[model samples]
Target: MGNSLSDGLTDAVRRFQWFYTCHVRVPHELVEHSALSLTEMRVLFAVMHGGACTAADISRTLGLDTGYLSRMLTQFERSGLIERRPCSGDARSTQVSLTAAGETGLSAASAHVRDDVSTTLDAMTPGERAQLIASMGYVQRLLSPPADAPQVRLRGPRPGDFGWIVEREAQLAPGGTHTQRERETRTAMVVADYLTAPDPLRNGCWIAEQDGVSVGASLLVDGSAGSARLAALFVEPGVRRSSIARRLIKACVAFATESGYGRVVCATDLNPVSVAPFLRPFGFEELSNQGEWEKHLKEPRAF
Candidate 1:
């Protein structure tokens, strides 16, 4: 069966793009004097977002082709919007920053965009605005960096993060043989259990947010006795294999240790799911079953 969710998400994105373009027309108006395109506006935003960036940095950040970025920079220089100076540390590269006129132009563009967004948001009811904001936040989180970055961070889940946790986990992790409906139902039950766990502190829930978006998440639950087990350790597909999972495992282990657990364990029916790849680096010992692993928190493990 076709997944309506994919179709819905695709249509929603198209609608949002149309809405944003229809309403946020003033940025183009502000830059009309320089004959800048929307693509050029994005280049300005890249430089503005990053205080001082080399051409390569801007190219990578904006996903602009080297040839296109070079042409754009040359045009921006002619329009007095930007200037490039030799990099102090790396003599081989040049750093680009906004000129006074460029700053003024950028400020005008930013102001117009802000005003348009604010006006649109203000027109909605409080509940509608909150829902819209939360939905946008969710979308941004799910589509963060293509791969995990070193700056990934772990923190306690906020008010509505459990919802996101469920959504991301269901989408990122394979559902095996369960029907779509059954998979969704089971996923919801698991999340509900996590939310209403008996011991909130002992059963820690953390989210890995990068660039102000949740990219990975993990949970620790009190096991059959005094021990605890790691559950729901997942990182988004785009930001995986970049040591994000390692950081997540460390966070869970730290929480379990602080909660007075003698050991932390993770059991799985699937062979080599997280064993050799993600967890073993943290010194987890395998059990006789070959499908379970445990890490005793005898002392603080240095990262």
Candidate 2:
């Protein structure tokens, strides 16, 4: 029994090592092919990703030592790969953009990196690919710094959840309003209408479950055959800080993408107090206010 236990622990460690190394070996391969120093390649990649970013932003994203990043920036300038200009918003900050030469060189470096990484991944069988994804998800959860619970599953609604959702309308409304109770009633009716619609694609709602309880919810309504709008989103009180709202929005985006909609939109009566921060991270941009917000959803993999 003791030998069996030891073997199991060894297997776990091996799986972890595999998970941590996924897609990470490509960078080292690219450094060799790009004929650029590792630091130079890293800075170039950062500029490529951020699109007119600053040294400080890159430093923060990569967790590089600030002085070292400064040296790298100077070297890149000397190499004519990047240019920095004074930031319009802040005099103390400098904005950086890539030159045409830099973009072409980085594109070549990226192609080499992708080829190397694909070769490594292709060695695995289909079963291995599935297992690797599962194991990586485990590692993500394990290494993620503790926070409010995250939502990872999406499923059909249950029988009693509708009433609980109705109750939520009252709880989510702002304080100090003569019309607070009336607004809650109206909101509940709108939600019920959405839930009872015959077609799931036409009108659907998802509840975000965290730690075995629903913390947030969203409703999606078909604007046309090809487009849908995210109607309502709310997170339970006290759980807002954990990023539950973002997870809920992600679920809606995933659903819309899988359901074959061209795009998804969200409208709120005034900008939703809880959703702006969440939606922004998922590439949802504000198109117009119009006494409500309009945000477009892209594919889930984009997140």
Candidate 3:
């Protein structure tokens, strides 16, 4: 079963790559109409966007050999498509910029490519287009290296976010004694309680986002004796090591401290070896019970 599943996945990836290379990247009409090869068009795009950049800069951005890039620049210069000038700061380096003619050529080529892409997308229904865009984004995230991961932004929960939080928490629940339905039910209850909190100032929730997609979440709610309980802490598996969980926890702790909570406590069934490192940095000490952790907060100043 495992071998069959692996083979099927490999075949699917190969098929997608073939389709993308043939149809999605630079349509044949673009090459024929613009008379610019793919590499040339990419170099021109870099130059146009880079704005008075050095040859070294373009070479780094495009990952082209310096010698090959120099040859291309020389050809462009001869054709009056680009201008090169000695760098004011560094005599050894040259600054490159597109000429007016270069911009015009790039714009025409880009329009042709845009029209071709639009023609393909126009055939899909709105729902289909949205699904395609979301699937492509998922593929990009799955394939991109860790260094290329999108920036995570922490924000207060918005309409529809609570539902997302519950759904994701249930989906990513750590395996143990609990069943999936039980986890989902518990998450729904927690979200309901947060939404119905009596004092909004005493309770808080943060949603961690990457490129506007929710990737993690946490809640700081009133606990016994002026304390806050951190609950529903979860980060998507793909984005786990990127500090999304840390950011969510930090936000919760900060909010708890600012809201004048005496301390914050968290209960979890997560492995202590894994959970301790993250919690310890925030001054969270393990309680006598194995699955409990707490961090004492300094009292906020009175007005």
Instruction: Quote each prediction's TM-score.
Output: 0.71, 0.44, 0.78
Estimate candidate 2's alpha-carbon lDDT, on a 0 to 1 scale. 0.70
| Best-to-worst lDDT order | 3, 1, 2
lDDT of 2 by residue, 1-303 (tens): 469889998899888678655737666777878788777787788898999998888998788998999988888888888999999979999998898988988888788667766887899998798667645554554555555445445455776666666667666667645556765676676676676666755567787665455666777776654777776667665444346666667777777877766677766642365567777777776666453444454433321
Better of 2 and 3 by lDDT: 3
Instruction: Give the CA lDDT, 0 to 100, for residue 248 in model 1.
Output: 81
Model 2 clash count equals 0
Itemize residue pairs with steric clashes in candidate 2: none
Candidate 1 vs 3: which has more lDDT: 3
What does candidate 3's lDDT look like per residue over 1-303, in tens digits?
469889999999999889887886674555777777878888988999999999999998889999999999999999989999999978999999999999998888778678878999999998798668756766766666554556878988887788877777677766754665577888788778888888777889888877656667887778877788886787776665538878888898888887888898888643345567778999999888557898999864442
- Of candidates 3 and 2, the better by TM-score: 3
Pick the TM-score winner.
3
